[model samples]
Target chain A: MKKYSDRDSLLIFIVLIFFFILFIKLMYLQIILHVKIDRVVKKMVTKNNIENSKRGDILDIKGNILATSVKQYIIFLDSKIIKDLNKIKMILFKYGIKIKEQKITEFKEKSYIPIAYNVNIDIANKIRSQKLEGVGFDVRYTRHHPEGKFLTHILGITDCCGNGLEGIEKKYNKYLLGSKIVTRMYRDGYGHIIMQDKLVDQSKMCGQNVILSIDRNIQFIAEQELRKAFDKYNAKKAICIIQNPKNGGILAMVSLPDFDFSNRIKNLKILRNSAISDVYEPGSTFKIVTIAAALDMGKIKCSDSFYLENGKLKLGGHIIRDNHKINGTVSLSKIMEISSNIGIIKIAQKLVKKEFYDYIKKFGFHSLTGIDLIGESKGILMNLKYWNHLTLPTISFGQGIAVTPIQMLSAFSIIANDGVFKKPYVVQEIRKVNNKITFNILDNQKLGKRVVSYETAQIIKKLLRNVVESGTGKNAKVNGYSVAGKTGTAQKFDHKTKSYSTKFYTVSFCGMLPVINPKLVILVIIDEPKSNNYYAAAVAAPVFANIAKRTAEYLGIKKDKYEIV
Target chain B: MYKYFLLIILIILSIFIYLWQQNTSIRFAYKVSNLQTKYNKISIENDLLKLKINSLLALEKMYSIADRNGLMRPDGNNVVYLN
Candidate 1:
């Protein structure tokens, strides 16, 4: 080595020191702060994107779309990235979206400004094709009811976030809401996103579809006829329910004063399904229960005669009078034919109070019908211990008791179904998005309990048929079909006066088509009819006859009544 | 010397294969992404069409149309049984 002076040696030492310092800095960066830097870079390059699936549909029995979810877009703007505001405005205007001056001003301060909502895919696609910078779209689903006001009470409504809020939507929400999937994506240098895996099949992740037992045609027919009567009488409320007595499937149910669900609901009270939620004194409809019980329990026979105290009798410090006066004793069938209140009261006296109450429970009164619906009432039934002498007699005439329209329909169905009580249901099946049936009503069908003997049921059917043939239900006669049913006109009880209102009455008719082997059970109730005539025979019976005639023609039930040429 | 040379060639080939696979995977990812977007657009169009069909065929709408056209429901006596 060559010997150097002091200056040269100092230069060499400084150079070596500089190299050592550089090495230390490199080591510190690669080890000590490595994890922090790596984490920051990863967060910038990778994204967690949440993918939303569409909600399922609700269909009628014949696979008609009753309710569905359509994919809509929320057109938003990234204020930070948006430039050329006029150009964006021009592009949006081409798609018929007029952004107000105030809204355009709002776009500057907010990072994300939602310009429009519920934008159709076609319009959204047109705007997106313009390739305007700083414009983004957020996908959303909006519920749609295609049938307008038909089945409003059953289809229900949903919230803005696509959650079911009422009716069938609320009862089967979990099965109707689809899954939300989170996926990991990588961002390239050009800002293009690269998915880590193949895109998921959206239909597989979608919610299960619900199918109801309601027939749209039958519903339409019932709605049309019931609405005519409702408007004609200017009734406060009207309800109609048609059921298949064999399977307990509700074919059609309509409640009047229905609102269009597509519009904003101002009066939420109308949302209550009066057919299942609201209760009324069933009036003469409950008489069927008493007559069936008496016939079944051997307390009275079809041939047994009861004296109708000259159409009036004093009982429990109250006077019970019949609509028709019959002084002498008449057969059980004749008593029901004339709908004699004193006749039914005399018949009810034969059974013990405990026995009558037991029969009522067995008929599914004072208990939830176990219908797959929301807000079902078991009706107002006093317990055995609370029963006064008036309770038994009043309940016998359908006075002191209350029942929902569905309960009354079901009670009559017991007679039509050969005295077997089957639980009424609207939801027929639950199917996957792939059309694979996951739940069927038949699979979960409960074996009907026997409420009366088959013979007793046959006798009641004949008696009901006689009522429609030549008695109070004569107005309910259909041309080609044999109708077996009863008429009820119950006076409304005034709470303030503690007496029955002379002006207000609930007129109803519950009947079955084809007396023997009944296929359809229909019940119609017109509450507080404001028309000149409010009798069950005049108001409710005519409506029932019209519905039965049209429904029978549409269903093509063979004509049981033949006219001799 | 020959065995060492063969080992080096094998390592080089393995690295080439690995690089080829990575490139193909990225290309496939891009293709899949494009296809997914097309599928979403088509499905949206299909849903809209289905909704349109249902709305047009609604019973109330059909009834009104019939009424406007003066088409009445056939009476029971006029209809003959087919079966």
Candidate 2:
């Protein structure tokens, strides 16, 4: 053993004291203050990032893309992190982006500055690959409607945040809007970020898709033919709808004066789907309801006769006249064939006022058709208590009553569908992001109520056939198909005059082809045609004929009438 | 003495394995982050290409093209159907 001197002993004691102080400091940092220090480090190195999921698409029945979201980027700059500004400028310039010198100087003073918008994915990738410091990108999705001016009212438009604003887009917004995800990212000293966990599958987080019942080809045909007539007549507005009578699925619906949704809408009123929103007196078309009701209730027989008073009569101090003159007693079929106002009034008198109102409601009037659209009017139907002496008579001829074109078409569809009233719908199915169908129209089809007896429907079908064969709707006849329908020419009610206008008229025609087993129920309406001839027979019937002929040929329906070889 | 030496070696080996696992996990995280970014870029590119295809097949464009090419709709009398 060696003995230590006084100076060496002091040195050893001092070293031991220094080591005791170091141990105490390490204990404080590792135990008592560990939570606080760890929190500070995480705050500096970790960031919260919100990832937006892509919105779902809108497709037609044939799986054609009608509306979709395309990924776009907002190229931005963070002046604090940006190094080598000239290098970024040179690279962006190569991609046809010119940044001003003044803007660059101003950007340095601000932390975040958006440099470019709607930068496509390719250009964004190229800029990102350059690894220019301080350059950042914000992901955005833009809603694009590629079929311009086609199905404008149906496809609708979206806001800047990709929310649907109108039409089908508004009605099915929830299913079309996808969920957003939040993630935490860890950043290193070099500014590179690594996710804390595996990224969630983006498609699984996306919104479900909406599939419509509208066929693009049929829509094109209807739009083309109706546009020609609309331009020729210089009408205020025109609407056409073709529906499948069996299931009440709308094949095509066109409302003219349609604005391209991609462009800013100046007049929002045109955005209204006039097919189901605007109401007008259906004129002779309403006569079908009166006649069908009378026939169904056993108020009259097919062979029953009514006196026509030489095509004119007076009721409730108002004189009504028919366009064609007929004398003495005429058969029930002839009354509908010539659209005799007096004959229809006499037939309506068989039913009480309450009975007529009930039938009208049963035909889906005075209520929403329950269409999958946002803005639909239930139409103007006065309550039964509001009926005066003239109400029943005038409504019987479609003068006092008001209905939307869709309602009138649906009413006629009741006869075509063997008296069963089916609700009309445009959305056919809703599918998940995984292509699994979640909701299908066929799966949820409602067994429609029977509005009239099947026997009565068949008889009314025959009467409508006669109207197109040799009566007012003769212009609606196709060459090889037996047709059934009615023509309507209603005078516009003037608010200023407080009476019907003689100069302005709304002419319309509703018809079905192959009358035995009708495939398509079509309605064409021309409002305020600026022509000398504004009769429904002349204006609306011909348009209906062109659409029917072409549609029939396109659908390849077996010809009902065969010529002898 | 030999038992004590073996115990010390085992403790040292366990620490080494733990450190190696921690380092390897971080490296794998970085690789996975790169792959996720690549996948997102490709998905965006695919969406853009689909939109392009739809734009090309728009009905109005096709109609005008057909009209310019002197194509006419065939009349019912001129068409023959085969079963």
Candidate 2, residues B4-80, lDDT tens digits: the string is 99999999999999999988877888888888888988898899899889988988889999999999889899989
With candidate 1 superimposed using the best TM-score fit, by how many Å does residue A347's alpha carbon deviate from the native?
Answer: 0.5
TM-score per prediction, in order, is: 0.92, 0.92
State candidate 2's TM-score: 0.92
Clashes of each: 0, 0
Q: How far does residue A441 in candidate 1 sit from its true spot (Å)?
A: 2.0
Per-model DockQ: 0.63, 0.67
Predicted candidate 2 versus true structure: per-residue lDDT over A236-335, tens digit per residue: 9999999998898999999987998667788989898889898989999899999998999899999999998887888867888888778789988898
Residue range A99-180, candidate 1, lDDT tens digits: 7778768656677788898899888888888899988998988888778788988888889888888889999999899999
- List the pairs of residues colliding in candidate 1: none
The window of 10 residues in a row where model 1 chain A has the poorest summed lDDT is A190-199
Give the distance in Å from residue A503's predicted Cα in candidate 1 to where it truly belongs: 1.4
The segments of candidate 1 whose C-alpha lies over 4 angstroms from its true place after superposition are A1-27, A77-93, A100-115, A131-135, A563-565, B1-20
Fnat for every candidate = 0.57, 0.60
